[model samples]
Target: MSNTIVANDLRKRYGDVNAVDGVSLTVEAGEFFGILGPNGAGKTTTLEIIEGLRQADAGEISVFGQSPWPRNPALLPRMGVQLQASAFFERLTAREQLRTFGSLYGVPGRKADEMLEVVGLSDKADTQVEKLSGGQAQRLSIACALVHEPELVFLDEPTAALDPQARRNLWDVLRAINTDGRTVVLTTHYMDEAEVLCDRVAIMDHGRILRSGAPAALVRGLEAAARVSVASGVMNADEARTLPGADEVTDDEVSLTISTRDAPKVVAALAERGALEGVQIKGATLEDVFLDLTGREYRA
Candidate 1:
C-alpha cells in the first residue's frame, strides 16, 4: 500500500522548548498507527504538523504525497481530525453538531445520523454539546471526524475521557472503519489500547521518537521476565524465591508474585507443590518496553 503520510526529521520549537525534535515516521494507507507517550511528549505537536494545523520549524511532511503545510486544501478534503480538546458550534445539539461538520465537506445529513449510530450517540442525538457527559462529548467529536468518511483520520487521545465500556465500543467503531480501508492515526497514553488497536506504534518522549515497531515485536524485543502470581498465603516470599526459574519474589497481603525468565518451568514447579490456586501468569507487554525506553519520571 502507498504511504498515506510521511514525515522526516520534523522539528518544532515553542520559544526555548523543543516541542518536537527530529521526529520521523510514516503511515501506510489502510493502516492503524499509534503514537504513545506521557504528558508533554511531542505526540500532539508531531500530529498537528502532519495534519496541517501547525507547521514545523524544520523538516518535511506529505499527506497523500502533497505538502501538508500552508493548509493544503486538497489534503483537507481527504483527511479528518479529532483534536484532544474538541470544539463545537455554540448551542448545537449532538445531531446538529455532526450535521454542521459534515456539511463542510458536502456530506449528506443522513450521513451525519449514520455516524451518530456508528459512535453510539444516537440516544444523545438531541442533547446539547455542552450538556453531554465527557464520554458522550468525546463520542460526538469522533463522529464529527468520521462524518465525511475521509480516507485518513487522525485521533488525538480519542478514548481519553471515555469510560471503559465506551472506550471499548469506540474501539469497535474505529476497527470497523479501518477494516473498510480507512487509515487511522492515533495518539494515546493507554498502552493496552495501542497494543490492541495499532498495526504499528511509535513511542516518543522529550520531543523525539525512541522506538517504533509492531507492538508485539517491541514487547518480544524487551526479553523481560514473565510474572506469576498466586494468593499470598500459597507460599512465603523466601519459598517462592527458591523455586526453579524464579528470579525474584514479592509477597503483598493479597498476592505473591514471582518474577521468572522461564514461565513454563516456574509454573510447573508451582503445580508440583499444589500451590497453583489463583495462579496467573503474565508475559512482557508493550508497557514494559515503553518504560524501558522512557525512564519512569513525571512529565508535565
Candidate 2:
C-alpha cells in the first residue's frame, strides 16, 4: 500500500520545552493507525503539525505526497480533522452545522444530511449544538469531519468523554469507514481502544516516540509476566506459592491470583491439585506494555 503520510525528524518547541523532538513515522493507505501518550507527551503538537494546523520548526511532513505546511489547498479536500475539543457555530442545529461544514467543501446538502445518519444522529438533527450531551457533541464533530468523505481522517481523543456503550458505538462507526478504505489516524488515552481498533500504534513520551509496532507484536516483545487466577477458596496463598514457577501469589476474599513467568507450569500444577475453579489466564496485554514503557507515574 502507498503511504498516506510520511513524517521525518519533525521537531517543535514552546519556550524552554521541546514539544516534539525528532519524531518520525509513517501511515499506510487504508490503515487504522493510533498514537498513544499521556498528558504533556506532545501528541497534540505532532498531530497539529501533520494536519497543517501548525508548522513544525524543523524536519518534513507529507500527506498524500504533498507538503502539509503552508496550508496546501490541494490537500484540503482529501483530509479531515477532528480536534480533541471542537467548537461549533452558536445557534446552529446539528443538521445545519453539518450542512455548513459540507458547504465549505462544496458538498451537497443531501450528502451532509446523509453523514448525520451514518453517525447515528438523525434523531438529533434538529437539536441545537449547545443542547447536545457530551457524547452527542463528539459524534457530531466526527460527522462534520466525515461529511465531505475525505480519504484521510485525523481524530484526536474522539471518545474521551464517552461512556462505555457510547464509545463502542463510535468505534463501530469509525471501523466501518476504515473498512471501506479511508485511512484513519487517531490519538487516544485509552489503551484498550488502541489495542482493539488500530492496526499499529506508536507510544510517545517526553516528546519522542518510545516504541512503534503492531499491538500484538509489541505485547509479545515485552516478555512480561502472565497472571493466573482462580476462585479464592480453590487455593490458598501459601499453597499457590508452592506451585512451580509462581513468582508471586496474592489472595483476596474474592479471588486468588498467581503471577508467573511460566504460565503453563503454574496452570498444570493448579489442574493437578483440582484447584482450577474459575481459572483465568491473562498474558501480557497492550496496557501492560504501555505501562512498562511510559512508567506508572502520574503525568500532567
TM-score, predicted candidate 1 vs. hidden true structure: 0.96
Q: Which stretches of candidate 1 lie over 4 Å from their true place?
A: none
Q: Which residue pairs clash within candidate 1? A: none
Clashes of 1: 0
Alpha carbon deviation, residue 125, candidate 2 (Å): 1.0
Candidate 2, residues 68-183: lDDT per residue as tens digits?
88999999999989999999999999999999999999999998999998999999999999999888899999999999999999999999979999999999988988998999
Whole-structure CA lDDT of model 2? 0.95
Cα RMSD (Å) per model? 1.3, 0.8
Against the true structure, whose TM-score is highest? Answer: 2
lDDT of 2 at 109: 99
In model 2, which regions exceed 4 Å deviation? none
Model 2: residue 50 alpha-carbon error in angstroms: 0.4
Against the true structure, what is each candidate's TM-score?
0.96, 0.99
Per-residue lDDT, model 1, residue 146, is 86
